[model samples]
Target: MKNLMKVIDALLDGLKRVLVRFREAKLGLLFIINIFKIPDFISDKRVNIINKFRLIFALTIAIIYIVSGIDFIPEIIVGIFGFIDDMFVLVWSLGIVNEEIEKYKKIIKKNKDPKIIEDVDFHIRD
Candidate 1:
């Protein structure tokens, strides 16, 4: 019975990791899609119009997943599930930074503005 319990515990641990990875992927995709919608990168006024509506929907899901601790599978049952949530946030944060860098690069390329480019790099360094 003890050995059986050990096996069950191990399986639960693995399951938690898998579920967390699933959540992280969902969050990451949403973030990447949003990055393309930023005003500077997108010229079409229509694009902005579409994205504003999309943003609301995306933000709603993001808020629920982040602010509400209710997981599809309860975190208490599999401890690592919460860690997965943290990982998702970490990845999403990194994606935001990356998107900002790309945005600045585009700005620098378009205007050939040394001051703006320098300012962007300065913030990136700090």
Candidate 2:
């Protein structure tokens, strides 16, 4: 029936939106946790010089922009509305820092226990 089809379509759309929101919430939570780890990551020498430099520079700029009055959106006139740009830069930079930290962690893990060739059945290619 037409009514049944409409109901099915509505349900699917609602479900899709819910799934998207859930995914966003999950990523937000991860971002919050990783944001705190920025300091540790920056201090970690194993993260490689390039990654460390990038993380430090990104964080410095974000912090400065958030705290200084010379932002693209001045909070003085717009009140809390000004924080939009500050939050955007902070979140964006923190996201990059988190990604770098994750990459370094993965690299460290892989190097620590490399599974190059261990305990596997082998077959000669014919």
Candidate 3:
């Protein structure tokens, strides 16, 4: 078991080195980070609605591109490895939507269970 783990670690080290050598990996990493940052954009009250709409539009386009075979010729020629990107995009979008829904639920809960306190002392005596 120890030997197997050692081999796996060696393989990962080599893979990491190769991935760093490839410049596209950094761009892909950034894309992944941006995808996860969707909730931040949604939660930020300071951000413009138009900017948020644009972000959603871009994500929709990315999903369309992944689902359609026109953007990537590999899907046209190689049938077996094609569904990977489609599945990835689907899961990513679902994850973002789920997170936003949870955040909204939290906001609603806070509103429903109000514990208001005013600085001027909101006290009423009959």
**Strongest candidate by lDDT:** 2
**Pairs of colliding residues, candidate 3:** none
What is the overall TM-score of model 3 with all chains considered together?
0.41
The alpha-carbon lDDT assigned to residue 91 of candidate 2 equals 58
After superposition, which runs of candidate 2 have C-alpha atoms over 4 Å from their true positions? 1-40, 43-45, 113-126
Best TM-score among the predictions, by candidate number: 2
| TM-score-superior candidate, 1 or 2 | 2
TM of each candidate vs. truth:
0.35, 0.58, 0.41
**Model 1 off-target regions past 4 Å?**
1-63, 112-126
Error of 3 at 110 (Å): 0.8
Per-residue lDDT of candidate 1, residues 33-107 (tens digit): 646555553453323344444444444565667677776555788877756764454444444434443444555
Clashing pairs in 1: none
Deviation of model 1 at 75, angstroms? 1.5
The deviation in Å at residue 58 for candidate 3 is 7.0
lDDT of each: 0.54, 0.72, 0.57
